[model samples]
Target chain A: MYLFRNYLLVFNILIFFQVSIFANNRDSILVIGKVSNNPQKHYSYLKPMLNYAVSHMKDLGIKKGKVLMARDNNQMIQYLQEGKIDWITESIFSALIYQQTTNAELLVRKWKKHSPNYYTIFISKKGNDINQLTDLKGRKIVLEDPGSSTAFYVPLMEMINAGLTLEFLHSVEKKPSGNNVGYIFANSEINIATWVFKGLVDAGAYNNEDWKKVDHTPVVFRKKLNIFHKSDTLPRSIEVVRNDLPDPIKKRLKSILLNIENDPSARNVLFAYQKTKKFDEINEDINNELNRARIVLNKVHENLNSL
Target chain B: MTMIIQCLKKINKLIFLILIPSLVQANSDLKPLLEVLKENETISSEQFEKIVDAVDNNDKNNLGIPAQINTKKNDEKELLIKIDNGLKISTYDGSANFSVGGRMMIDTAYYSDDKQPIGDGTEFRRARIEFNGKMYEVWSYQLDVEFGGGSADAKEVFLSYDGFTNKRIKIGQNKAPFSLEELTSSKHTTFMENALPNVFAIGRRVGILYESYQENWTFAAGFFGESFDNDVSKEGDESWGLSGRTTFTPVSEDTKVLHFGASLNYFDQEDNSEVRFRSRPESHVTDTRYLDTGKIKDVEKQYSYGLEFAAVLGPFSFQTEYINTHLERKIGGADDLDFFGYYMYGSWFITGESRAYKSKSGKFDRVKPLNEFGAIELALRYSMVDLTNGSVTGGETDQYTFGLNWYIKPNIKIMGNYVRVDNDINADEDGGVIGDDDPNIWQMRFQLDF
Candidate 1:
C-alpha cells in the first residue's frame, strides 16, 4: 500500500511540471517599428515602404505584424532577440554580428533605390584643414553608434589600413578642438554629422545612402569638410527571421516573400517601397559573401587590439 | 497420387504435434513423428499473411515454440546480476559501475615536553565513501565524501569530459595544488593527517580543475577561489590561486616504483581582508604551548613551495617531502618569515605480499593480501617544524611517531600508532621549583578506514 502511494505521488508531481513547461511555450505575435534619424529629412522617403511591409504581414501568415518607430539599430536588435519582434530589416553588417549571439536569421535583403551596393563616406567639418586621412590624426571623429556598420566599421577599417589609428592627442583641456582626436557615440547619424558641421567635433563618418537624403549637407561642412575615404560597397539591409521557427511555417514565409513582386495580391505591399524589385533566394552563394565580411570585420577587431 | 501425399503431410503434422509433447514429457522422443513435422513445407504467402495479422492483433495461439527465447532470457539475467548494488535495484554493467573506497587514519603521539599534547590522540581520523562510474562512453561522474570527519562532507562531485584528449577536464571542485604532502591522498599518507607544518601550510581549496594523464606521467592545474561551502560572500573577495604538479614513473613494471613532484601557490586577497597562511601547531607536553600568549592572528600575504618523492621495493615502501613557506603580514613592515619542514617515512608489509601502486589510479592497489588470513604492516616517521620565525608564535618543535597497521581486506584496515612531542617551555609550577623548561610526553591512537 505504501509503495503504491509513493508511485502515485511521483506521477502527480511529474505531470505538474510537464504542464508548467508546456504553458510557458505558448506563442504570441511580436510588433516592431523603424524610423530614420532625421525624420523630417528622410521619413517621407521611408513611410511608404514601412506601411507596405505591415499590410503584407497577413498574406505572409504573420496575422498581426505591428510597426514601431525606433530610430536606431541597438533597440531593434534588442527587441528582436527578446521576441518583442519577429523580424528585423537591418544592414548586412549589423545582421552578421547580431546573429552570432542570437537565433535571428536573414529573411530578405532590401534593394535600396534598387542598388545592391552602398558605401560609407567620411567627412570633416568646414574650416578644419583635415583634407586627408593622415591629417585627421589627433582629431576627434563622431560615430553614430557602436553597432552602426557604415558609420563605425567602414571608417574605422579605412583609418586602420591608412595607419591613422584611434588615439588621444592631448588632455581634454588641451585638445585643439574640444572633440578633436577622439571618438564618441552621437546616438544618431544626423546628430553626429551636425556635430562635425558645427565645430563640436573635428570630423564625422556616415553611409552614402543617408548622406544622399540630407537636404542641407551643413554649409559649414561643405566649406571645410572633405571626403577623406570611402569604404567598399556594403550589401543593403536584410529582413531577418528567428532561426528556430518551425520548418513548415518558415517555408511558407519564404515562398510568400519570393513570390511577392509577381503576385498581384502583394502588389500594394511592393508598391509601398519604391526601390524594392522582388524577393530573391538566399543560399550558399549569399552566405559565402557574408562569411567574407565576417573575416574582414574580425581582422579589423584584431587591428584595434594591436593599437 | 499428389493430392493424397499433400493430405498425408497435413495429417502427419497434426499427429506429430499431439505426440511430441507426450514424448518429451516421458523423456523418450519419437524419431519418426519429429522427422515428419521437421520435413513439412513452408506456408503459402496467403496463409503466412493471415498468421502474421493474427499475431499482430494478439489473436495467435503461439503453439509453435521459439528456440532463441530461452537464450535471450538468460543473457538478461546475467546483465542484471552484474549491476545489482547491495540490495538496491542496481547493477554493474555498461551503464554503471561502483567503486568502494575510503581514507581512514590514526595518529599516535609522544612529546619531549610533558606539558603539552599537541596531537589529537583520538584515532579513526577519516573514513570516506567514493563512487566513480559511467553511463555511456561520453558521460561519466564521481561522488566522494568523507564520513568520519566532523560531518559527512562532499569532497568531489564532478562530471568529466573523456572523449577528446588524453586528459580529462573536470568541471567541479576537487583538490587544490600547494604542498606535496597536501596533494598526496590521505589514504596512502605515511601519517593519519598531514604534519603540524602541513596543517598551517596547506588546506583544501576548491574550484574548477583540469587534469591530464598519459602512461607514467600525470599533470594537473586549476583556478580556485569560490568554494561550494561559501559561494555567496566569496565573490568580491576574489583571491584566485593556481597550482600544478606532475609525477613520473621512469620504468615499466618495476618492483621499486618512484614518484616525484613540485608545486607553487599564490593568493591575492581583496580590499582590507588580507590572504594568510592557516596553521594549527601541536604542543606535546601539556598540549598547551602558549596559554599565556593570545590566539594567533590571521596573516595577510601567503605563498607556498613543495617537493616530494616516494619509492616502493619488494614488501617495503618509503615516502618523503620538503616544503618551504613564507608568510607576509602587515603589522610589521614586510616581515617575510620563511621556514622549511621535511620527513622520511617508510612502511614494510609484514605479510609476504608486496605493495603495488597503480599508475593509472592515483592510489595504491590491493596491498599486503595474505594467503588465507590477513596482512600486517609496520611504519615509522620523524618530522621537525621550526616556528622560531613562525611569524605567529616564535617557537620551535619536533614530533616522533611509530605506527602499525592491519589490513583485514582489500577495502578495510585497522591501525594503531604512538607519537611523542617535544617543545620549549617558559615556566612550570612543580614543588615551588621550576622543572625543566622542555617537557616530555606520549600519545596513542586507533582507527579504521574503509
Candidate 2:
C-alpha cells in the first residue's frame, strides 16, 4: 500500500508539472520591443533572452513571447501609443522621447555595454595647445555620425553651452571661420581618433568607454591625446513599459531583470544582450533626469538642423 | 509619489463635487456631471465600483499590438543564403536556418608481410549525408547517415533545445558524452584513423543528453541505450548505460588553448550477456586484428573512465588521452578484470594555420588553411592498448604513427599516415593468428565535406 501510494503521488506530480509547463492559452503573450535599424542582429540577441524570461512567466498569464522591432524612435513611440508594444529597451535620449509622446514610464535602467552610465570626453593631441573648448576656434574637430549620443549630442551641447559657434565642415582640411569651431563627421570612433592624430583635425570627442577601447582608441593614440573636457553623465540605457501595465506582470519582469546577474547561468544571455552587466531600479529621480534630457535633446536637435 | 499626489488632487475635486450636489441638490446638470466622473460616489460603492473598474480596464488596454517582425505573409518572408564552411539558408528575421551538407573520405593502404597475411586495398572510408537546421530560434536538429560499409548506419540523429540561458537538452540517437576525441567530429581529426585507444570509446548510441558550458568550461551528462545497428532479439531487458563528461579550459581561444577533461561510462549487461574487445593496428585499410579478447560470458557490468589533456600554442598543438575499463563477472569471484589504453600525439602546422578549438562543445573543430595552396601539417603519435588480465588475455600492442596532412580548403583535405605496430606474444587474436607478429602500414586519404 505504501509503494502504491508513493507511485500514485509521483504520477500526480508529473501530470501537474506537464500541465503547467505546456498549457498556454492564445490570449496572453509578452512582447519585448526594440527600436533598431539593424533588426537581424538585434533579433539574435533578443530571442534567447525573451525565451528565457517567458519560460519562467508561463503561469503569470504569459504563455508566449515575441519581438517587435521599430525602425526609429518615431515608429517606436507610435508603437507604445497604439499599445502595440509592452516593453522597450532604449537609450536615455530615446526613452525620454517615448515618455513624452506616450503613456510609458521607466521600469529599470540597464547597464548597457557593462556601463551603468556614460559621458562624453573632449580630447586633443598632447602639446597641441588645445587645452579647453575655448581653444577650438579656427580649428577642425571630429565627431562621430549625427545619430550618436556621446560623440555628437553631448559634445555639441557642451561646446554650444560654452559659447563657441560650430561650423559644419564638409572636408577635414577645411578650417573654421575666425570665431567658429569647425566639426566634421568621422563615421566612427576609430576614424575620429585617427583624423585628430594625423593632424587633419585639431580635436576629437567620444564616449569614455570608447576612449578606453583598443579598437576605438588604439594604444598608439592614447599616448598622444589629452582629455580637455568631460560632459555630464547620463543613464546608459533604460527598459520602459506601459504606465498602466498590470502590476503583477511589471513586478515579475522587474524581479527577473534585477536577479539576472545573481544567477551564473544567465551570464551568456546577459553578455549577448549588449553585454549588459546588471539592472537597477528606476526611482522617482527618473523624472528629473528625463526632464533634463528633454532640454539637451531639443538643443542638439535645433543646432544640428541649423547645420 | 506622483500618482498618489494626482489621485489625491482628484479626490479633493470629488469631495467638492459631493458638497456641490448638496449645495445645488436641485440642479439636474450637476447630478449627471457628478455621476459621469464617478468613483465611490456616496453609495455603499457597489454600483460605482463596477463603473470605475470598467473605466480602468479600458485605460489599461489603450495600447494593443499591431504589426511585428513576424507580421509578414508566409510567402513574403525573405530567405537569405550563405556560403561558408557549409551552404546555409536563414530567414531575415533570424528565426530559422537550415543547411544541407555531406562528407567523403577515400583511403588506400599497403601492409607489410607478417606471420599472417593482412589484406590491404583501396576503399571508401566514410560516405555521409547530413541535414541540420534550427527553427523557432531555440530548437535545432541534426540527422546524419553513414553509408561507408555498403550499409546505412544512423549517426547523430537528434533534436536539441537551447532555450535556457546557457544550457542545452538533446534527445534521440547521439553520442554518449564520453571521450574528447570521440566528441570531436571525424572530419576534423588530424590523422587518417583514430588512435588505438578508441577501442574504449563509446562512439554513438540512442540517448538523451543535457549539456551546458561557459567561456572556460563545459559539463555534459546523459543516459544511453544500445546503438541503432544493434539488432539483437532478446526476451529479457536490453543493455543500458550512463555517461558523463566535464572539461575545463584555463585558457580558451582559437589559436591558443589549455584544456583538461575527464569522462566515465557505467554500463549494465542484460540477463544473458557477453563481451569482446578487439582492435586493429591503427590503420583502417588493413583487415587484420592482431589484438582480440575473443568473447567472455556471464558478464554483469562494465565501468570505464578516461582522462584527456590538450593544448594549442600558435602553429603547434598536442592531444593525449588515457582510458581504463573494469569488468565484473556474474560469478563474483577473483574473475574481475581490468584493461587500459592510452594515446598521445602532437602536430605542427607549417603554413601558419592553428588548430581550432570550440569551447562550447569542448571539442576541436575544422582547421582552415591560411595560404591559397594549402596548410601543411606534420604530426607524430604513440598509442598502446592492453586488454590482458588474469586468466583472460585479450592482447597487448604498441603502435607508432607519422602523419602528413594538407588542408587545401576549410572543408577539403588530403592525409598520409605511416604506422609501426608491435605486439606481445599474447596478441594472437584468440589464437586465430600468430602472436608477436609486428607489421608496418602505410595509408593515405582524400577527404572533403560541405
Best model number under DockQ: 2
Which portions of model 2 show Cα errors greater than 4 Å? A1-27, A33-48, A51-63, A67-259, A263-276, A280-307, B1-97, B112-117, B134-140, B161-163, B234-236, B332-334, B369-374
Compose the digit string of candidate 2's lDDT tens values, residues B1-450: 979977886787667646653444333234344365453334325544543443333322221102122222322134667676577776645567788899999999998867778887998899999999888877989999999888998888999996776688999899898898888998999988888889989878888999987757899999988887776766777788999999999997546899999999998987647788888888877767878888877789989999999999877999999999998988754488899999999999987677889887899998867455888999999999998998888889999999999999888999999998899999988898999999888999999998
User: Which segments of model 1 are wrong by more than 4 Å?
Assistant: A1-307, B1-70, B73-113, B116-124, B147-152, B230-236, B252-254, B271-300, B329-332, B361-368, B425-450
TM-score of 1: 0.44
Q: Give each candidate's interface RMSD in Å.
A: 38.2, 11.3
C-alpha TM-scores of all predictions: 0.44, 0.64
* Model 1 per-residue lDDT tens digits across residues B97-201: 344545555445544444333343443455567777544433567788877656877877778765433446776767775555665565555445466557444
- Using lDDT as the measure, which candidate wins? 2
lDDT of 1 by residue, A1-307 (tens): 9999999999999999898765443232334334333222232233333344445544544443343333445445555555555555567776775576576777766665566657878887655687777777777777765567787777777777777656422222334343224666676766766677667777788887666532224222344456776777767666666676556556655666677777665443453443466667665656665776676567665654443
Judge candidate 1 at residue A87 and give its lDDT: 52
Which residue window of length 10 is worst by lDDT in model 1 chain B?
Answer: B60-69
Candidate 2 pairs with clashing backbones:
A83-B63, A83-B64
TM-score of chain B of 2: 0.82
